[model samples]
Target: MKKQSFHIDGAKVTVYLDGPAWDGKPSATLGAFSCKTMQSGTSVLAQAISFVRDQGLNQIIGPMDGDTWHSYRFVTQTDGSPSFLLEPGNTPDALEVFKKAGFTEISGYFSARVPVVKTALTTPTATTDFTIEAWNGTHPEALFDQVFNLSTQAFARNAFFKPITRDDFMAMYMPMVPMLKPELIFFARQPDQTLAGFLFGTPNYAEGPKPTSAILKTYASLSKGAGQHLAHAFHKAAAAEGYETAIHALIHDDNLSAIRSASEGADIFRRYGLFGLKLNG
Candidate 1:
């Protein structure tokens, strides 16, 4: 991947060429797109387009910081709800800027929310070979190592997935350690003590003055029903913690996780987009 930048009349934009796409494909992306753009101030957009052409890239995806590992989508639809933690915040003008620059929606994502009480009765079928436990801040490194291993396989087929070293993975989560609530994170283990799944949750730090909500950040499984088992256990634990609302953060429209969120009575309150443009157009 190659990184390039531009400064057009004091407006700066950054672009990446041949980077990983959501589906682990390679594509060019325009990002770090910042400017007080108006109808007359669209030079920045034109410059970005020029950069894509100069790179000999046939297509360009945008607003992606670099990859899915960081921030990527634009908030294409919203119910006027306040943003949640890790949620992308896009301005109205930013959306128009991309649209005017010949970009089209290439992918869609949504975040949903459900009341903890609604999922209180959610229970996955019992699996005799697997056991579930809460993450209690015990030997976090070891736990993370196990999670990284499972994730390497579980998310290998996921969009924009890039193989990362164990150290890099731990480093990413280490900063969030202070905000972690043990009850909200769970792990599923097999009879042989192999880690099979994990569910990560966090307090809704984005909810107004005080966060009455929590976010189901991410979860992965190496066994059947393990994901559901972890979610059920995590939701019950969140309810016990007095959290009224639970957010299913950023589910792809066609992803199975979205169905699970819907089954739990969650409603899609926010939608996001990853835009793309063909250089020839």
Candidate 2:
């Protein structure tokens, strides 16, 4: 993707020319966005808009680094909780910076927390179509390859979805292997040994060395009921491991995952959004 950076006053933003489509039209994405003052933010955004329009694109989205595979969205609301590991964060004025630049919320997401014991007790028993297994902490590379494949298939239809190379996906996750708790990551497999789903959870390392909460970072399913079964297995394992809470991280508002979180008694503690701006020709 071709990228250009724009700066105004103390603010800076990067414009990615070959961004994912918006409403079926080509879009330019703004990333690495930062600004101390609204005036500077607006000015820099104007420069980005002009540059994109000159390239024959009229739609823009940000503050995604490039696509959904990377960090994106601004924290729009919070309940005073501290951020978790790998959570995307921005300056206090980040949301307003985009709003003042004529950007509107194009997508919404949330993070929720639930009691591990409660979720474990309430989750339905596993379906017979798939059996859940935990990662054995061996051959970490192979583990992520399976995850990357399942993720690409499961999230293919998601909004702003973009395919990432397996190497890029592995590079993004391999470093976290040391922090992973084998019991918290699960794989759902069919009778023929085909992988149907996976759940990757980690301890809230940001909460310090001995954390009480587990973060359900991500999970995806290709078969019916596999996702729910994997989640059930994760919660049971987390509770057994003495984790008191589970954080369902970065769930899209309309996704079944969000509904599952709520049904498991998770309460929304934070909200996030992606912003978009439409330029006039």
Candidate 3:
């Protein structure tokens, strides 16, 4: 996981020499990227490319901060809406800069907004073998451990996936414990108490002190219908708590979560893309 940094007239980029592979090819990641102008950005990117090629890598992805667990992707499109809590954002010209540097979209994602009432009404009743329960805010560490385990399993097959240590995962989420609403976070368990799924939702604090929108940040399921059941429970609870809107945040374009968001009448409000460049030997 060696990293090298490059600079060009104030523009800077860091290359992670041991980044996750892209399409089974050796790859590097261009992260910690910044540039004040297109020319500087392009120059810096070219330097990064050269550095990656010298390492015998065939692909490069960015502007990820080493991995997907942190800030990544550029806001390629938007509907004039303000950014949300924990949303990844970049300079307005960042996407164009990447395009001019011979990078193309390697992955696509979007965030959508829907009325809580509509989502709650459209979601089918939970009739699965698993039962959904709200977190009681007790034993917070144990709860996150369950979430970390389920997330690793559920996202194992996702593109550019990488394994993270449990300590790192906890460090990333522990601070948010104070902001979490027990009702909005749920877990699906089998009759024998085996965990099947989990949903982590939070209020849109980026909106204001008392936000009306709830964010469905992340959710995963290992059992059939458990995902939908967890989502349904979240929406119902949000509506009961007087939340008017729900934001389905950062769903991959081809993921089932994206389809579920659309089926619930969510309107696409913002789009993002992870850019990639192919290195020539």
RMSD in angstroms between candidate 1 and the native structure over all alpha carbons? 2.3
Any residue pairs clashing in model 1, and if so which? 22-159, 22-160, 24-160
lDDT of 2: 0.89
Off-target runs (Cα >4 Å) in candidate 1 are: 9-11, 21-25, 39-41, 208-210
TM-score, per-candidate, Cα-based: 0.91, 0.96, 0.95
- Candidate 1: tens digits of C-alpha lDDT, residues 1-281: 47888776646667888566543445787777766655433677787778778767677787886666667888888899888888878678778888888889988899998998888788877888789999887777787788789888998887666577777789887778777888899999999888989999989887765678989999999888888888888789888989998899998888888889999899989999988876664
* Model 2 misplaced regions, further than 4 Å: none
Measured over all alpha carbons after superposition, the RMSD of each candidate to the real structure, in angstroms, is 2.3, 1.3, 1.5
lDDT of 3 by residue, 83-139 (tens): 899999888766777888788999999999999998888666656588999999899
Query: Sorted on TM-score, highest at the top, how do the candidates line up?
Result: 2, 3, 1
lDDT of each: 0.81, 0.89, 0.89
lDDT, candidate 2, 72-166, per-residue tens: 99999999899999999988776787888789999999999999999898756646798889999899988888888889999988888877888
As for TM-score, the candidate ahead, 1 or 3, is 3
Candidate 3: C-alpha RMSD to true structure equals 1.5
TM-score of 3: 0.95
The prediction achieving the highest TM-score against the true structure is 2
